[model samples]
Target chain A: AQRVTQPEKLLSVFKGAPVELKCNYSYSGSPELFWYVQYSRQRLQLLLRHISRESIKGFTADLNKGETSFHLKKPFAQEEDSAMYYCALSMIGDMRFGAGTRLTVKP
Target chain B: DAGVTQSPTHLIKTRGQQVTLRCSPISGHKSVSWYQQVLGQGPQFIFQYYEKEERGRGNFPDRFSARQFPNYSSELNVNALLLGDSALYLCASSSPGTGEKPQYFGPGTRLLVL
Candidate 1:
C-alpha cells in the first residue's frame, strides 16, 4: 500500500522567517512526488514536482529517496504564502495525498 | 487554453439519491482523474481514465463509477449516496503521452448530502 504523511496540520510563522513543511511517504517503487497548493477561495493547483526540481513562488521541494521524504521549504515566508499545502505521490494512477498543512504567515 | 472544468459548482442531495457530475478536460488532453476531498482532509483518488478506458481505480466502493468519452470529457456517477459522500469532487486532466505530471485541476464540485 502507498501512503503519504504530513506531520503538521497547522503551522504558523512570522513574515520573512523561513518555513519548512515536512512530508514522508511509504511506497514500494519509485513514485512521482508533487506539491499542491490551494489558496483561499481558489481551486487547488500544482505548485511544483520533484521530477522537474523547479521552484515555484519561491517554494522548493527536494525528493530524498534515502529518507523517503520530500519536504517543502521556503527561505522567507510571505503573507500571501498562507494557504493549504499538500504533499502527494502517485504511481500507476494511484495518487496518495498527505493530510495537508495549513500554513499561516503572520505579518 | 481553458483549463479543466467541472459542472455544477455546488449540489445538495438527500441520502439514497444518485448524482452525476460532469467534467471536461483541457483541449487535447486524453487522461482524466477524479478525486474526493472532504473537509479538513486531503483529496483521495477515486478513478483515472485514459483513451476512454479505465486505467486505474482507488479504494472506493462500487457505488462510484466513471466513464471517459472520446473527446476525453468524463462523468462520475454515485449511487445510493450516503451522508459521508458529501465532499468536493475534483477533476484533473493530464496528457500522459506528453507527461502526466502537474495535473491541471478544476474548481471542483461541492456536493452536500443530507
Candidate 2:
C-alpha cells in the first residue's frame, strides 16, 4: 500500500528563520507528490506540486526518488507562513495524504 | 469562478440514523471526490466520481456510498452512522485528467453523531 509520512506533527520557528517540513513516502512506482496548506479558518488549498517544479508562496519541494522524500522547505519563514502543511501522494484513482505538520512562525 | 461548494455546513444526527451531504463541483470540473477529515488528522479519501461514474472508492464500509449526477455534482450518503463517523466531510473537484492535477477543496461539512 502507498503511504505518506510527515514526521513532525508540530514545528515552531521565529520569523525570518529557515524551515523544513519533512515528508517521506513509500511507493513502488513513480510517485506524484504535492503540498497542501490550510490556514486558520480557511479551506485547504494547494501550495505546490512536485510535477510543477515551481515555487509558490516562497515554498518549494523537491522529489527525491532515491530518498523517497519530497520535503517542503523555505529559506525564510514569515508570520503568514503559519499553517497546517500536508504532504500528499497521487495514486491511480485515490490520493493519500500525510498526517500533516502544523507550523507556527512566531513574531 | 466559484469554487467547489458543499451544502449544510454543519449537521447533527443520532446513531443508526442516515444522512446525506451534497456537493457541487466547479463550473467546468468533471471530477468530484469526497473525503473525511477528523480533527487534527489528514483527510481520508472516500469516493471519486467522474462523468457520473464511480472511478474510485476507499476502504470505507458499504454504509458509506456516493453518486454523481449528470451535471457532475455529487452526493454522499451514510447509513447507520456511528460515533466515529463524526468529522469534517470535505468535497474536492478537479478537471477530468490524471491525479497529478491539484483538486480544489470546498469549505467542508462538519458532521456530529450523537
Best by TM-score: 2
Q: Give stretches of model 2 more than 4 Å off.
A: none
Give the per-residue lDDT digits (tens) of candidate 1, residues B1-114.
Answer: 779999999999999999999999989889899999999999999998888888889999999999999889999999999999999999999875522557889999999999
Q: Please give, for residues A1-107, the per-residue lDDT of candidate 1 as tens digits.
A: 78999999999999999999999999989879999999999989999999988989999999999999999999999999999999999878668899899999999
Q: After superposition, how far is residue B47 of candidate 2 from its true place, in Å?
A: 0.5
| Candidate DockQ scores, in order | 0.69, 0.79
lDDT of 1 at B114: 97
Q: Estimate candidate 1's alpha-carbon lDDT, on a 0 to 1 scale.
A: 0.93
Write the residue-wise lDDT of candidate 2 on A1-107 in tens digits: 79999999999999999999999999999998999999999999999999989999999999999999999999999999999999999887798999999999999
Q: What is the lDDT of residue A36 in candidate 2?
A: 97
Q: What is the TM-score of each candidate against the true structure?
A: 0.97, 0.98
Model 1 Cα shift for residue A75 (angstroms)? 0.8
